[model samples]
Target: MTAPLQGKIAYVTGGSRGIGRASAIAFAEAGADVAICHLDDEAEARTLVQAVTARGRRGFQMAADMGEVAQINAFTAAAEAALGPCDILLNNAGMNIRNPFGEITEAEFDRMVAVHLKGMFFMAQAVYPGMVARGGGRIINIASQLALKGSPGIVTYCAVKAGIIGFTRALAHEAGPRGVLVNAIAPGPVETDLTRARGPEWKARISASLPLGRIGQPEEISATAVLLAGPGGSFYTGACLSPNGGDVMH
Candidate 1:
């Protein structure tokens, strides 16, 4: 039972619940010290920290609104102070506004962009220098299946996610020569709080549409993140792994 990320350090945003929480636990369990940033979910974040510590990995928790650049900077500072230089950055903090294109407002569109694209940009920038100094690091951005194939109603979300994909590719090229690897994952619908709110009927339909005939679990997504962060995926860069259960076959 060798740990792939033994003694590594990872920072995950929106780590209080859903995919971020699962990825944090996976990283810690794989022998990496974990730092998590959450906006308003202190209790859950604390519990996750405890869980990481239980796995014999150091855990750091920070409260920051990732949508704000100032807050992102402060959070990155806190994370660095607590966890030391971040070697693995999981840009998992994201927001979605699902509504008809006609009903979407300017502010709504901006908010969606801010949380996903802007936040991801700043977080990646914050970690780049440290990663470069260490001679290498890994960055994994979380995108969505909708980014590849647009979905109705949430046009803004589709655009932002698409931007993430482009961003991941461009950043991967920029970071690769410096020994860093950047990749993205576009997960299909999962059985999480966000999907649960989409109603039981929609959930059933989505599951039926998938080749696997089932919705994905957070743990499954976390497993992929773990592999990408470890040496096993050192040669993988700018690769957008789609865990969509055959929804978007290329």
Candidate 2:
């Protein structure tokens, strides 16, 4: 009956919906107070806050772009102010522009770097010092299976995700000994606004190609996060846990 994350505080980026939202609620259900940041989903963010409160957990939400350092810092300060110092950070805010290699624009490339690389890098920096000072914490970055296995038409996305894998592993070395654990989850095609935009044909085709004969759900991916952020994940650091329906086995 004891909650694994009881008395812990979790800060999640892009948590208004999908895997981030699911994990925020899951953390609360496991007894952690959650604070989330969204780009422009006040309605969804409000709904998520209410859901967390419904479960008798403190919830806080802020609207900010993860790509902007000023916004990331402000959001972090606000979240900690609302729920106390963060014990877990989910750098899950992300976006992708699925343009062909030849058609990828400078603007598009810049945005992807800003959101995925810079966003995650600074967000982790923001909370890591606090976590280490407190003697232990969790940092879970959302990566993609495509990072390991090459994919066409989303070259930039794949490149940046691969960068995340590198970042997670490198950070674990510096933070692990300091009592902060860093890891990543490289998920397969999942049901999200981004994936659904690919249409049913693409979905069905991709599903048939997977070893599991199906794509993944947000909760399924979030479950990996729950394990990483909970007591069970204490021994794991610098590890990449893939729940990608056997898309890329390692």
- lDDT, candidates in the order shown: 0.92, 0.94
Q: In order, what is each prediction's RMSD in angstroms?
A: 0.8, 0.7
The residue-level lDDT of candidate 1 at 16 comes to 87
lDDT of 1 by residue, 1-250 (tens): 8899998999999998999999999999999999999989899999999999999999999888878999988888888888788999999998778789899999998899999999999999988998998899999999998999999999999999999999999999999999999999899888888889889999899989988998999998998899899988988999998888888998
lDDT of 2 at 92: 99
Candidate 2 Cα lDDT to native:
0.94
Structural similarity to truth (TM-score) of each candidate: 0.98, 0.98
Best by lDDT: 2
Worst 10 residues of 1 by lDDT: 92-101
lDDT of 2 by residue, 1-250 (tens): 9899999999999999999999999999999999999999999999999999999999999999999999999999999889899999999999988888999999999999999999999999999888888899999999999999989899999999999999999999998889899999999999998889889999999999999999999999889999999989999999999999988888
The runs of at least 3 residues in candidate 1 whose Cα sits more than 4 Å from the true structure, single-residue gaps closed, are none
Which residue pairs of candidate 2 clash?
none
